[model samples]
Target: MAPTRQMSRPEESTLDLGEFTLKYRGDALPQPELLVIGKRSGRHKAVHTFVNILDNDGNLVRQAAITPDIASFIFGSFEVRGSTEAFNIYESDLVVGKWSPRTRTNVSPDLVRHQRTIAEQSFTATGGKLAHHWPIFQKLKETGFGSIIRATLTLHQLCSSNCPFCSTILRNKRDSVSLTEAQAFVSTLYNEQAALNRNEFVRYNEEYRRLTGTDIRLKGLILSGGGQPNLWPHFSEFVRWLGELDLDVGLITNGFPPKIAEDVYERFKWVRLSITPESASPFYPDGRFDRQYIPASLRHNDSLTVGLSYVYGPWTDDDMLKRLDASAHENGFRYVRLLTDCNLTRQAQLKAHQDLADRLFRLGFIDEVGKPLSRIFHQLKYHGSQREAEELWSDGQCKLQSYNVFWDTTGHEENGYSHCYPCDSVTVLADEQGETDISVSERRFNADKWGTVKSTEVHRLFTEPLQPFFDPRDICASCLFMNNNRAVSDLVKRASYGDMNLDTSLEHLNFP
Candidate 1:
């Protein structure tokens, strides 16, 4: 019989209200140069300030100092009463401007028109498979080209953790994608467009060039799966293969085996370690488990960027946050991204957490704050936080339809999984036997055993209409990605229509 694994208890702590203490360790750590605050209520004010730090050539330098006065004022102003709040600090240029929780103004009209055009064309092209293809079109339009910019390779279907909030963990099984199949897929992507006979590749590039006059190419790869990618038997070979293709690779793992830490440093661009409040205890001193994980050599490798992804919520309190921050700084992590739980019913809790997280993130009161946070920091980052039917509809349109593609080793069309919307640039899937297969369904992996890897087949499957499989309108009613996309799409539409107010007190714009 297989040995049973022990499970940790869920973290349960209230929000930390008086943990607003901020201190500078010394010149060894980077300092913030700009402060951005999004005031949801109270005075309805916005604050954006840039510290005086520039070289002779006018380039931003890292010598900026945050005096006690400046730091106090920045933190003080961020403590405002509001349902929605956002606070961000930057080490370089200030990018925070007056933002409205109810309204936003940075939308580009041309981009909106371009996105709309692609949406219409995709609807007509796929005879209505817009839902499945919206993510693809959206990504293409974002890059202004037809080349596959990024692809996610789901390496295996095995994991050790059983986090209730994880979709992949619940579906975990003892299987992995065949190394040969993985190499074949990579070869297909590495070959020149002309060398391949896929009509979709040809037509996508042709349309993109015709519209923008630039060629498309794949640039990035994500190594992720149901289980820890480093656990895969051929992880090193796969990393080497991706390096050979000249694609920037990123890894998502639970940080085990320790050896892959050094191996990934030599080839991958970045590695993100997923941590949870309950599971994080093992890596602490009392657990004596750190010796089994990443070593100091790998952590301090300057060439290899490292970061952490932590799921935050009511159960994660100030104590945990402080511990996480210290761990990141001591271990040489570039950043710690706070993620909300994936359970869709926690909308209220998620929003509340977002507000608290914004405050914590802005004050640099919790965790190390060195660079501007991702957009997900200011808004909902996953579908699990979505609520309201109208939030799923955007101007009665699906703006990002046909924007990306996803596959598993099984090559099945669906993986029996449901998300707010299809957001992956492309996914590679594996079957029960650890072999790749062609899949047809978006929410689940419905395998097409007879499907081939030809370009035409790839294009047809990727560009297929959504109506035949599911009603686009009904399926989107609860999608979390729709609202986020719509928010950005509306911004672009308004900007194009000359309806945006560009004059606001918050000066500076930079998204890291």
Candidate 2:
């Protein structure tokens, strides 16, 4: 098939306070007429759109509903229109709308105030001032050793399935944190308030309570690791100990070993099953239990929220989506999360799958209102636009240098240390003795070190600026997680400041 042709000359206008660039062919339209700008394919295979609208001033007096067919258009010709308010018609940010001419502007002061209040509250609660105080070392300060809200317990490093896309397959060693170590880690975080001053601790705790309606020191415990968490030898004991802490527990697993279904259903508040075609194959000629185990296990656990996670690539298509949806419906899975492969080699494949995923979302095959699914889609779109804007607006600062914390088994018998690095680009190594350690380069920069569970490192990391271990620009340049986090932080900063030009960088703002 022949490709679509581009316009020789196109009229253009800026929308959403210049967040989106809109171009149309032919003459400009008159004012008070609604203009709909939909996406289209531009020259050099770029994604562009066409503009048209329902004319309430003339014969068509009703608001036209945007369907998937209108939204999926690559590009088309239209006459430019007058300056007016653009109504964003979208579902979970997947379908973005350019500015449309409107008769009257829809402004809600209460909604604006509410949004700003939420942004300010989140910024303040999550150590907002720390980012401004030492912008370079902000991420490091926020994610100090024990300061992390969600703690992931690596029960053991062992899995039955050999999924090709699994990051765990890269690790050469297998090990798990002992029950004693896990207990110590949780206990330390629970009792250790030495890092923060009394007043600061009180304020943080109060803010957390107000935000989450919980007075617990930590948010929740996540039972996850490079391997299958349920395959650990002491899975039940670990779950019981975490329950004793009086905190919610979450599990991420391949949904194997149907024996532990009751325990998991009773103990875990939420569980995510990493489902893939190979793992959930229907052609179980060998009568392997993996195929039937997940559905059978989850059939009775209606109270426990079950989410299905799938990594989409070039192989994913409409048929696969239908199969996935059918499986979710049959297994009583309440939510489905389709994710793109992060490996750079699969970028093209990822893009293919992303386009397909967007189409599937627009077609209503996937649940739009489900938690994490819609949220992740919005984040994907927002980050994409944010990255494009960064080319023109960024000041070469890293927004996620020290934002979140991650801990893995160091294979050290004496101590299990938490590696403090940007969550986006993590590189761990093993010493001559095969014990897990941070890479040598990271160690040289003091980015990797031994952090005891009881250490006051968490408090100090949040309140005080640590010595710079690495350049933020070099490390965080291509990190998607850092970019997304920074984008969110920037949004909060912009909203709180009431800045109309959100495209500009706000790294210098201290949020006093």
**lDDT agreement with native, every candidate:** 0.39, 0.39
* Candidate 2, superposed: residue stretches over 4 Å from native: 1-147, 194-200, 259-261, 279-290, 295-297, 300-302, 315-318, 345-350, 358-403, 410-469, 491-512
Q: Number of clashes in model 2?
A: 12
Cα lDDT for residue 405, candidate 2: 39
TM-scores, in order shown? Answer: 0.52, 0.54
Residue 100 in model 1: lDDT:
18
For candidate 1, write residues 82-137 as lDDT tens digits: 11111222222232322212211221212111111221221112122222222235
lDDT (Cα, tens digit) per residue for candidate 2, span 1-512:
22233334333322221112233322332211112222211111111122123233211122332232332221221112111111112222223433233332222222111111222222122233333322222222343322344456655556565442344333323445667766766665455532342344454455445544544244556676556788877787778767776576777886566556465456777777776544223233343323456544466467666766676543344565666666667667665565544332112222324354455666565343321232122112111223433552254433343333344553432344433333312332111111111111111112343232222244443454433344434333334344345444553343232222321232212221
Model 1, stretches more than 4 Å misplaced? 1-147, 192-215, 259-261, 279-292, 295-298, 358-379, 382-401, 409-421, 424-469, 487-512
Candidate 2 TM-score over all chains jointly: 0.54
Instruction: Predict model 1's lDDT versus the native.
Output: 0.39
